[model samples]
Target: MSKLQKSAWFNLGLITISSLFALLCFTVAASKIEKGFNYINVILCLAMMCIIIPLTLIIAKKKSYEAGFDEREKIINQRATSLSLSGLIITLYFACFIPFVALGGGNIIKVVYLPVIFICTIFTYQLIKSIAIIVQCALEEQNG
Candidate 1:
């Protein structure tokens, strides 16, 4: 497997694990924490972020930028990054409204879950982007 693929799989695996943990935050601790949009308990979500994000950057940097990218492949990566940025932006905007949409003005669980969703969504974006870039580069290489 290529360096890019390794990076993607590493990110996907790490974030998938975290995403499940985040989902569990709702189902497991929803009743345990005091309610009503509490931001304090977002600490667990923060812990996940603090742990996973550095790992992602480290893996991505170690990923072979040595692959000697051509213009088309570079373009593919650029486009993928742009798309990921767009995804995070949209997630940020929409997450802000979660409280307004919940009818009862949301719960602390939902508050906690919002960052989880955003973090997972960003991971999702990065994974898809890297995969798309790898595929596009492979196809371009084969055609030439």
Candidate 2:
């Protein structure tokens, strides 16, 4: 596999595992907290998972000066990035408007929901980008 493809796969795996781990931790912690649920704890747990972004970038960075990317790879990357950005926009639109439409203008949303929305946006972007890259690469391989 090409470096970019490998990186995409690594990101997909990292995201999947970290998300599952975070969910498991949250579930266990929530069960144990008898007093009541805490938004801070949930936010902190998600923020901790955000660390994976930098970690993925560091791992995916090219070690040598010559990062062998051809025109096809570049095109694939561009297309995948564009597709992901489009997905991000759609996700944001839904996230922002859905509650507003459902609840009307006078209703208030919790402050804690802001962080949840941000995290969900980030996940949506990454998920779309990774899936796009993988699918595009596979299509190119088949066409060749």
Candidate 3:
């Protein structure tokens, strides 16, 4: 696989892992609070982000100017983002049902759905990029 493809796959994996962690935190927090913010969960989530940032930085460090990318990568990233955004919009469609926000971290369904939203966004983005790459390869073979 090309470097970009490999990176995309890697990112998909990271998103999955991170999402699982988020879900675990939400669930644990929800169980303890039963519909409220558990300070522990918030802290955990924050810490996770802290950890993720450094890791992302490390990945960026591995790539230099040449590894930066070209038009194809940009297109792939664009499609991936677009797909995730569509999913997000669809997910948010449910928000209209939410009577009031002032959630203050005290809603069972909301807590459960929060991680899910992240999952949907990440998966959609990865899926689009993966599909795009496959289609590109198929077209190249046919044309060649």
Each model's TM-score? 0.58, 0.74, 0.57
Model 3 segments more than 4 A misplaced: 35-43, 51-67, 94-144
When 1 and 3 are scored with TM-score, the better candidate is 1
Per-residue lDDT of model 3, residues 84-122, tens digit only:
567667656645344245453455454555655664555
Give the per-residue Cα lDDT of candidate 1 at 22: 57
4-30 per-residue lDDT for model 1 (tens digits): 545556666766676666566544445
Candidate number of the best TM-score:
2
Ranking according to lDDT, highest score first: 2, 1, 3
Q: Give the TM-score of candidate 3.
A: 0.57
How far is 71's C-alpha from truth in model 3 (Å)?
3.2
Candidate 1 C-alpha error for residue 120, in Å: 3.3
TM-score of 2: 0.74
Clashes of each: 0, 0, 0
**lDDT score of residue 70 within candidate 1:** 55
For each candidate, what is the lDDT? Answer: 0.62, 0.73, 0.59
Q: Cα deviation of 60 in candidate 2 (Å)? A: 9.0
What tens digits encode model 2's per-residue C-alpha lDDT throughout 30-115? 55454576886667566656765665565456335125778888888889889989999999999989999999989998664664
